[model samples]
Target: MRLDKFLKVSRLIKRRTLAKEVSDAGRVTINGRVAKPSSEVKVGDILEIGFGAKMLRAEILELKETVKAEEAKNLYRIVE
Candidate 1:
């Protein structure tokens, strides 16, 4: 799955376009390297997102094309 799509489906960013914009602006990284919105996301990959004064990190667990709201959290594991 694409990084941006994964973010939206995972409910990390809420919207695909916002995720893409943030990614394009270099506010997101994969495995500690800057990643584009089109970047491929696979299971076990680490993602870090900078949200100005705050940051978020997560480990990809599953990558499905679509998931229910109740199942969204199952897609990734929050990392401290």
Candidate 2:
């Protein structure tokens, strides 16, 4: 799955466009390296996102084209 798509489908960013903008601005990383909006994402990959002074890290557990709001959390697990 695409990084931006995963972000939205997983309800991490709420929207795909925002995810793209965030990613394009170098506010997102995969495995510690900066990532792009079109970056390919796979299961077990570590995703880190910067929201101003806040940082979010999540480990991808599953990939899906669409998921319900209640099930979004199952796609990734938050990491400290």
Candidate 3:
């Protein structure tokens, strides 16, 4: 799945457009390297997102086109 879509589908950023904007601004990384909005995301990939002064990191556990709000949390696992 595309990084932006994955972010939204997983409820990480809440919206696909916002995720794309954030990714385009270089505030997101995959496997430690900066990634673009269209970047591909796969299972097991590490994602680090910068949110103001805070940061969120997670590992992709699964990729789905759509997921229930209650099940979105199952798509990725938080990482330190």
lDDT string for model 2 (52-72, tens) is 999999999999999999999
RMSD of model 2, in Å? 0.5
lDDT of 3 by residue, 1-80 (tens): 89999999999999999999999999999999999999999999999999999999999999999999999999999998
C-alpha lDDT score of every prediction, in listed order = 0.95, 0.96, 0.97
Each candidate's root-mean-square deviation in Å? Answer: 0.6, 0.5, 0.5
- For model 2, the run of ten residues with the poorest summed lDDT: 11-20
Error in Å for residue 6 of model 1: 0.4
lDDT: which is higher, 1 or 2? 2
Report the backbone clash tally of model 1: 0
TM-score of 3: 0.98
